[model samples]
Target: MTEILLIIPPFCYGDLSEAGPVYPSMGIVCVAATLEHAGYKVKIIDMFAEGYEESKLKSCLEDPELKIVGVSSVSATFKISLNILKYAKEKRPDTTTIIGGPHITILPDETMKETYIDYGVLGEGDNTAVELADLIIKNKGSPENIKGLCFRKDRTLIKTEKRQFIENLDELPFPAYHLLPMDKYRSYGVYDSGRKTTSMITSRGCPFKCIYCCSSELFGGRWRPMSAEKTIEFIKKLYDEYGIRHIYFQDDEFTVSHERAMKICDWIIDKKIGLTWECLTRVSHVDNELLSKMAKAGCKSILYGIETGYEEGLKQIKKGITLEQAKNAVRLTKKNGMIAKVSFILGFPWESKEEINKTIDFAIKLDADYSFFTILCPFPTTEVYEQIAKEGLFVPEFNMEMYSAMPAADSLIRTKYLTSEEIVQMMGHAYKRLYFRPKYLLKRMLSLRHFSELKRNFKAGLSVLRFTVKSMGKKAKLAKTT
Candidate 1:
């Protein structure tokens, strides 16, 4: 059997990572599950989980049995991911190197420019990874034959025919959680209690044409999900085998099909699978019945992307929801005893200061249990990124590091009406305004049910303060410069 190594490079997740919410990479873990099931010896190195020890990575690279080295990365971590593979090649020239994830999937040819990477897997890697590994390990077939793959051959980059999205998601193996450092995962302040918490994706893709999202491109703009039975089984496996007490569903819209979601909730209720969970979904996809069932079946939190406050900004972003719908969704979520966490993005290229302020005002007025205000990050492969690129909207200081959407981080692009610095300052102001309110603080304090909740709140609040102050300093500097 061929020994395969899959790596997730150390990437800063900004405030999220700073506030202690490290998670396993679902992409690589899924790939590992498929590869492991296919009889390959697979090892997963989560650099972030293990604290990025160069000596450990060096040791892994030295392993003679490691026939293939694979890495997964997003736009923010592409540079580090590339450097890792480059170093792997330098250390072990015999090992075949591959890279994949949103960044490489969007720009295959550009990623292949680094000769260190022998192949790039586009979109979902579960099936593609297995086929590629078999071909490489057995020297069985040409790289050109593999769909959803790109490679440099004879100094020419070749991307094969587009791979179809996996239709029956249930056929795919559950993510190989055993390969991950599961104990290292945490979800403090975001999920209840934080202990034994991990993230799962029950579905893939988004049907809505949200301009800032790349899910439609990556997952074929369809909502494909595992059967409710399979989903329950996976959840049970996590609870029983891994002792996972809390789960954060990383779905773009977990409640896309209310029927399926209701069935899932029913199973959790019937089986008494008592693990509390949280998920992200569109405002319109959820309603009173679903919220009621979700709360009963251990859904402690629900996060919604209310991208902007006003109607025009929402339309511009193709968010496909009205302010009234968002308000109703939040109201229902909280009414059903689940925490409603809403996120707003400021700094659209066409947005005026008043519009951005309106978004902040809306967030405060909506009064969800948690509110996150982020500056717009124009990720590649999204409609917003294309628009920004076409219009030369990116700021001079914009870089991949700012792609994490850290409120304090420099905005990547500027609107006609606002500079990047102004956008970031507004993000700071949004946080300070919403979080520092005596009403919000009193509500949070009253809602605390445990010491863990209090500790998590304190830590999270401290993180927000630090970021807010950092953002305010940038504003002061900008004022001086002007």
Candidate 2:
């Protein structure tokens, strides 16, 4: 059996974004299970859990007989993956290196331009990865036969035909959670109370066409779901085996099928699985009745992407949810005694100062337990990215390092209506308006019905303050350079 190393790079935000304690890397676990099922010796090194530095990562790659290395990358961690790949190639010149995940899936050809990465996997990677491993084990380097793969041959890039999306999500095995360093992962809500927290995915893909979102493109526009019974069974297993009291559904849209969601909720309730969970949901898919049921079924929170408050800005992004609907959803969630986390984005090209103010005002009025605001980033392979590229709106000199932290004054894109500084200033103002209110603080303080909730909120607030001060300092430094 060949020794294959699957490395998940460190958490790239580095205290910039709220790190949310640490959890097992689901990507590596899924890939490991697929390879192990094929009789391969697989090992996963989750650097985020171990707090491994660059030197440590380099030392780990010193294994002389390692045959293959697979890395997973996201938007914020793409540069980290590149660095890891570069180091791995230098350390083991003969080892086959592969990169996959959202970043590479969206830009396969561009990713293949790097000599360090020998192959890039697109779309769902479990099957593609197993096939690639078998091919590598057989001493075959030809990538043309593999679907959803891009490689180089004789100094030219070659992309194979795209593969169809996986329709039967249930066919996939449960992630190889037992193979991970489980003790390293600690959740604020769990660790502080000596409880346990776990993360799981109930399904994949989103049906929405939000212009700024790439989930629909990455996981096909149609939603593929797991059986409710199977999902509940997994939840029960996590609770029984790992002593997990909290779970996060890490899905793009948890309520894609309301009927399935209700069925799952019923099963969880019927089984008396005493696990609290959170999930991301669309504003349009939620209702008072459904929210009530969810709260009863142990759902503690739901995160909503209310991109903008102005109708025009929402229309430009094709978010498909009205301002009224967003407000109603928040109210319903609160009415049902569950926490509502509202997510907003600022500095869209189509947004003016007036439009951004609308967002701030709406956020202040909605009064969710927590709010998150991010600058609009035009990621590669999205419609928004193409529009920005065509209009020459993107900063041509921007590199992946610039994405590590939140966009500073100098890093924000200049729009026709707002300068980069103006956008950055508006983001600061949005945070102040949404979070620095007496009512907001009071609501947050009073909402902590349990000691676990109180501790989680306190830690999260501290993290936010630390991030804000650091971001402000960085912005000031960037301003001086400019």
- Taking the tens digit of each residue's C-alpha lDDT, what string does model 1 give over 243-284? 999998998899999999999999888888677988999999
Compute the lDDT for candidate 2: 0.77
The reply for model 1, stretches above 4 Å from the true place, is 397-408, 475-482
The CA lDDT at 360 in model 1 is 86
Q: Report lDDT (Cα) of residue 108, candidate 1.
A: 75
Q: How does each model score on TM-score?
A: 0.95, 0.91
Check candidate 2 and list the clashing pairs: none
* Candidate 1 residue-wise lDDT at 447: 84
The TM-score obtained by model 1 is: 0.95
Distance from true position, residue 320, model 2, in Å? 0.9
- Top model number, TM-score: 1
Clash pairs of candidate 1?
349-415
